[model samples]
Target: MTRTVLVTGGTSGIGRAIAARFAADHAEVFISGRHRDTVEKGAKEIGAHGVVCDATDSQQVAALADRLGKVDVLVNAAGGLPEAGPGGRSALDGLLAQWHASLAQNLLTAVLTTASVQAKLANGSSVISIGSIGAERRGGSYGAAKAALAAWNASLSAEFAPKGVSCNVISAGYIAGTNFFRGQMSEERHGALVEETHNKRPGTVDDIAETAYFLASPGARHITGQTIHVNGGAFTTR
Candidate 1:
């Protein structure tokens, strides 16, 4: 059966790769991006449908849900380090802006998107939210938001798992080939991250894509409400 899969932030980075993975399997994939042209372009490249949606906005998210029939898999991949505005009137103002941006982009996007489409999720479906290792480390505001994402998933799973729906968070780390760093990643920083990994290499988008694919598979039905770390040993759980 062709799965009806939806991926937010599918224009680039990890989200794009996940969408492509599903599309390659002939799944009925739909990708959502905040920009129209970017969504169209990404959809064309991945052979999937595209919707213009800023996941942080409830109205747009509602419209997106209305457009879908049944969603077999919902990947809440809309999030990143939001760029701070030009200036802040005061120190407190800047802090507020940064924290708000972090929460809205990293946390609220997933919450709003999932809630809006909650009814559309089919039985035996999956809800996978993209998370970060920052939540377990020096993530600051962004990390705090991601940690909350996992906490929310726990409750979400308990509510949905009884109906054959699985919820999970994929906590990724040091993934390369994406604009995640916003062009601020220095070579020294990159090397330091890679050195900490067991494999001595940075993660690829495909790594997380494959993990997402597996978690949605039948083998992963018993793996709900868990945070699957894909950091290549950069962050290990004892």
Candidate 2:
């Protein structure tokens, strides 16, 4: 049977790639984004359903849950580093804003969306929350949020495992072909990031998409409550 899948922040980059991968396999995919145009465009391009809903907003998330009564796969891929706060703010205020925004975007978005869809997750459902390699080191506010995400995934797995559902986190490294840097990363910084990886090359969105696809497959049914690293050995686990 074709499974129903929901991917948040699926308008571009890693999220969009994941949505496309599943759509190509003929899954009933629904993608969400904060903008109407991007969501519609992405949905059309990938032949998946589109919903303009910010996962960070509770009301919008509730409406999304209503629209998707049940889902077999839920990919929480909506998150990114926010630029500085509004101009003319004190350093402390700006710092606080950055932290709050990071938490809301990276951590709370997954929390709220999953909570809203708790009941809608069918038996044997799979939940994959996208994390960052920044959580390992020098991530600053964004890293903190991602660290908390992995911690939450542990608890989430325990809760869902009893119901035969799998919940895990995909700790991704520096992936190319994404607007993640937003044209802010210097060429030197990019090279440094790539050099840090064992492969000496940046990752691709497809690498992550394939990993997610496997985590939801029957073979991965035995895997749960784990953080799978896909960062080309950038951050090795002991």
Candidate 3:
């Protein structure tokens, strides 16, 4: 059976990889992005359908849910570092703006999108959200938001489990191929991150995509409400 899979923020980076993996499985894949051009290009490249919707916008999310009909899998991958707002601001102002932006981008985007599509999720369906290992060690607004996301997923899983729908978070670490660093990371910092990993290497987008595919597979039906860390042993939690 060709399951319908929806991956938000799938225009690039990890989300794009995830969509491609599902498409390769011959699933009916759909990718969402804020830009029409990017969404069309990504969908064409992966042979998946494309929808233009900003995950953070409630109206757009509702419209997207309406357009999707019923979905078998939903992947919330639309999150990243907050963009800097207005210029020449005070230190305190800048900090507050960043904090709010982080929460909105990292936390609320997933929350709103998932909530909007909750009723559309079929029994035995899967809902996966992309998270970051930064939530464990980093003490910043982005980390805080991601931590909150995990907490929320725990509750969401419990609520949906009875209906045979599973919910989980994938906490990724040191993944490359995205504009995550915004060109500010130095070679020394990159090297240090790789050294910290037990494998002495960074993760690839395909690594994440494979994990996500497994989680949504029938074999993982009993594995809901869990945070699966895929960081090359960079950080372990028993």
Backbone clashes in model 2: 0
Model 3 agreement with the true structure over 1-238: per-residue lDDT tens digits: 7899999999999999999999999999999999999999999999999999988899999988898778899999998998888999999999999999888888888999989889889888999999999999974898899999999999999899999999999999999768888988888988988998999989999999999999999999999999999999989987
lDDT of 1 at 203: 99
TM-score of each model, in listed order: 0.98, 0.98, 0.97
Which residue pairs overlap in candidate 2's backbone?
none
Q: What is the TM-score (0 to 1) of candidate 2? A: 0.98
TM-score of 1: 0.98
How many clashes (backbone N, Cα, C below 3 Å) per candidate? 0, 0, 0
Candidate 3: list runs displaced more than 4 Å: none
How well does model 3 score by local distance difference test? 0.93
Predictions in order: lDDT? 0.94, 0.94, 0.93
Task: Flag regions of model 2 displaced more than 4 Å.
Answer: none
Q: For model 1, state the Cα shift of residue 35 in Å.
A: 1.0
1-238 per-residue lDDT for model 1 (tens digits): 8899999999999999999999999999999999999999999999999999998889999999999999999999999987876673698888888899999999899999899889888778999999999999999999999999999999999999998999999999999999999999999999999999999999999999999999999999899999999999999997
Error of 3 at 201 (Å): 1.0
